[model samples]
Target: MSTDCTTSSASTLTRRSLVLGIPLVAAACVSPGGGPAGPWRAMSYAEMYGPVVEGQYRIPAIDTTTINPAFLRSEVSWTGPEAAGTIVVDPKARYAYLVQPGGKALRYGVGVGREGFAWNGNARVGAKREWPKWFPPKEMIEREPRLEPYREGMDPGIQNPLGARALYLYEGQKDTLYRLHGTNEPKSIGTAASSGCIRLFNQDIIDLYARVEMNAPVVVRA
Candidate 1:
């Protein structure tokens, strides 16, 4: 995707600024639960929402009541070419699926790239970071001079646009500048509002981060 910042503020950069790297993995029949063997039980709204304390950082709980129900995390049937453990993003549907065994996927509502910023292709989760920093791309700074201060990078925290977790996507050895990351703007879920990256709720991202393995495949579909 081309350089574009979703917001004109200095605090965030266009989704094109996010990039990642990792090797590919073969397809496997892994359970959707991603844990002990058993029927996958869905997490209740209360169970999924709350303050998440990771190390010194405390991620505040999301007010699920304000969010659309369709955007909530849940498991759904999936029939895609990707293997289990692969991350499949359906931009038009505004949903992301973490493929699981038995024709199932852990589906999560997401905020996709805005019209002109959309991109699609295969990539891999090259790296992962917690409370990742934010750096406005050079082109973004040129367009919005107010972002000049963040040209170097912004410190990680709740205010950061990347939110609590980030899974960088790469194609072969090249950085695609796209990400499957947590978003500070939870309200943006189920909408096409980002510059190019895919956004998930903080709690959902944290859960996904724990289940996803390094070098997992990611397929973004337009």
Candidate 2:
């Protein structure tokens, strides 16, 4: 597999940005008084109609950066214990945990299934790609032939399905037929719905995608 961002195989994708030890840097571009310009209004109608995640996520923007902490779940914490493993996704709490030694975990607030359709159990991130070319599985093409054209590939840009990054999931060295990836849907950041893949704000995934390895174990919980 290529460590570089380019798609090695024809089946995968290449990220537009080469992630090479990039540090998270933020300057106080906003004037000191105006109550920080963040958590803007939801863009899509579905998300606007639906409930908001409050401070969990924010609408995507170029200049604005939405880097919220994971421990801000507030009243959404679960009764059950947190999973102990390499990775964990507490969908109910809308947080994903990357377990590490010394009892610390790298946690990130995530957008889960809308109406109880989230994926669970153990899986591995077999491959990682940037701006992945979305080849809708055969089942989708069968139902909607219009998508057949995408079987080839799509380049990186605003319209790309995989957004800024993608982390491919596999179950025991096999493709799980699912992906934990990013989406351009800014409104869908907090709530899940009719979207096909698990969507995250592009910046969030760019952070998450760089943290995990190619074969890291993932455990999604209810």
Top of the candidates by TM-score: 1
Q: For model 2, what is the C-alpha lDDT against the true structure?
A: 0.49
RMSD versus native structure for model 1: 9.9
Give per-residue CA lDDT, model 2, range 118-186, as digits (tens). 566778888888666766666655665776676565565446766667777787877775677766654
Q: Candidate 1 has which clashing residue pairs, if any?
A: 4-14, 5-14, 21-126, 22-126
Candidate 1's residue-wise lDDT over 97-182, tens digit each?
88888787888889999887788999999989978887767766787687788888878877787888889888998777788888
Runs off by more than 4 Å, candidate 1: 1-32, 35-40
Model 1 accuracy (lDDT, Cα):
0.71
TM-score of each: 0.82, 0.60
